[model samples]
Target chain A: MPERGLLIVLSGPSGVGKGTVRKAIFESPDNDFEYSVSMTTRQKRPGEVEGVDYYYRTREEFEALIAEGKMLEYAEYVGNYYGTPLDYVNQTLDEGKDVFLEIEVQGAKKVKEQVPDGVFIFLTPPDLTELKSRIVGRGTDQLDVIEKRMEIAKKEIEMMTLYDYAVVNDSVPLAVEKIKQIIKSEHLRVDRVIDSYLKMLKEL
Target chain B: MPERGLLIVLSGPSGVGKGTVRKAIFESPDNDFEYSVSMTTRQKRPGEVEGVDYYYRTREEFEALIAEGKMLEYAEYVGNYYGTPLDYVNQTLDEGKDVFLEIEVQGAKKVKEQVPDGVFIFLTPPDLTELKSRIVGRGTDQLDVIEKRMEIAKKEIEMMTLYDYAVVNDSVPLAVEKIKQIIKSEHLRVDRVIDSYLKMLKEL
Candidate 1:
């Protein structure tokens, strides 16, 4: 039997470096990961390529897809609609290529409801202190915004229980290596082995 | 909160390189695996160390341990009693070290009943052809014995579903590496994370 691809849903609290770790893994020749392009009604940022950065769409088109039940999950943030399209994910899985859904806690939960077999992973900081330091080091938000973000992060960390695995993003290279190992070992799980080999043995 | 160790139960069909891969992993400095010694009535081999290899015991003592429910799993083979002692395993786990139980299918099932949290792994050859070649290469068993072993191997492969992970023994180094990843990832599973942090996080 041909091998099936894995749907890896990666979620984390704010400032856990999910983007950095994911970039390192995908850039390295060792991993073959496809980024799932989300459909968004928000204006495309400068230099963000269509279908690469996101599958940009109008609000009406996005709402149509949602009503058609093609969206795995969707939300309106600051009046912009963002959603995960189900067709592309299913197609990629059928082609035996892994697709990563790098989302927040709420989005991850929604995806899990639709695709329960996907590998749900939560990225974490080394500790709360380090997480605070990382968030401060970014130097992007004011004190009030930072405090609000910290509160959200705490709540999200509590929701780590909703994930299957928790990866600590202490360092980009190390975190990428650990996640790579997880993907490799998950392929060798018993359920897959049984699905791939069970009935064939009887014929042989 | 203190971290807990894992009970790793490794099982495979006869002559499937279970011993070879296990030896390679234990010999490596990369892993900190503790070998669980079995209480056995069989005579120890020439080079086999007493506590390191097997805890040699009289039948009376072994039966007494079994009656006391001290045996995690016990089996009789060729008029010799061999069983895993629960005290030793629990002690090793308390020390926060991974313990390997290299037993066969029947003993593995028994042990699973007692230690339901153990990570049960089934090791396999690349295929039956490779398995047959490996057994024939050893040149130890008669033709009838080899045939019987092959039949048993087939039956054991059918029971691969009983395991959590299935490591194909394509190469000793590769198999060892896969198992290492499994151990590392299992440590990061959400259930363990919850067990280690659920109560402590509330205090913060």
Candidate 2:
């Protein structure tokens, strides 16, 4: 039988270094997992190609897909739609390719509702103080905006109970190692590997 | 806050290298996990310690624990009572140490019922032929006994669906590495870690 791939959902509070960890995991040869390209209504940034970073879509197109229930989970932020494409993820998994979805708290929840077996990983800062420092260091948001983000982070942390595991992003290398370990361990799940062997044994 | 250790259940067919994998995991200094010493009525073999390999118990004591609902799960096999001690497993978990229970198929299901959050791992042989070879290679069992063990292995493989993860023990090192990964990934579960952080943030 062909090996199966795992659907892993990576989420965290803002400024927990999820992006950096993800990059490290991808860069390491240890991770042959595929990344799920998201569908978004946001305009492509500089040097971002269609279907590479995201499947950039018009609002109407995004809405049409939503109405058709084609999207696994989607949300509107700043008047733009951002969500996962069910077909892409399912296809990758069917090909025995582990797929990683980097999304926010709400998106992760929605994906879980749709795919309960999907591995949910929450990245955390070492401590609250470190989280605040990371947010401040970003220097992109005003004090009030950062405060609001911190508030949101607190709310996201409360939802950690819903996830399958948590990794503290104390160091990017360590966090990436943890993420890789989760993916490796998930593949060992018995339900995915045993039935076929059992059937073969029965035939014998 | 100190990190909490996970409760891991390792179950698989006999001669599938479950013991070997467990040994490797325990031998690793980086693994920092504890094995749950089971309680049983079986006579201790040579070199076996009462509290280390197992808590040797009389049939009456085993029955008493069962009647008192202290045993997580108990069963009679060849006139011996074998079961997991609830207090020991709980105490180890509470101490922030991950507990590994190397159990049979039946005991694994019972443990899962008692601790739904516990991670269940099922080790499997690469194939039936290899399974038979391994059992025979042990040089301890008679032909009839080996045959009976294979029959039991077949039955256990059918119940694979009850497990959380299945790992094929084709290679000892590979299997151990996969298990190590699972333990690491489980630590990253979002709901468990993030929610606690979020709760602490709210209180702050």
Q: Using TM-score, give the best candidate's number.
A: 1
> Which pairs, if any, clash in model 1?
none
lDDT, candidate 2, at B108: 85
Model 1 CA deviation exceeding 4 Å by range: A129-154, A202-204, B128-154, B202-204
Clash totals for all candidate models: 0, 19
lDDT of 1: 0.81
User: Across residues A70-189, which tens digit of lDDT does each residue of candidate 1 receive?
Assistant: 998888899998888999998888888888888877889999888888898889877643454544656777988767756765676678878889888877888788788888888888
lDDT of 2 by residue, B1-204 (tens): 455668899988766777888988888788878888789899999999989888999888988899899997777889898888888777888788899988887788888888888888888767643564555667877988877866866776766777777777778888888887777667666544554565445553
Candidate 1 Cα deviation (angstroms), residue B63 = 0.7
Q: Pick the candidate with the highest lDDT.
A: 1
lDDT of 2 by residue, A1-204 (tens): 456688999887767777788878888886788988889999889999998889999999999999999999999999899999888888888888989988988899899898998888888667653565655667677888878867776665666677888787778888887777777777667766665566555543
The C-alpha RMSD in Å for every predicted model, in order, reads 5.3, 6.0
Q: State the lDDT at B137 in candidate 2.
A: 63
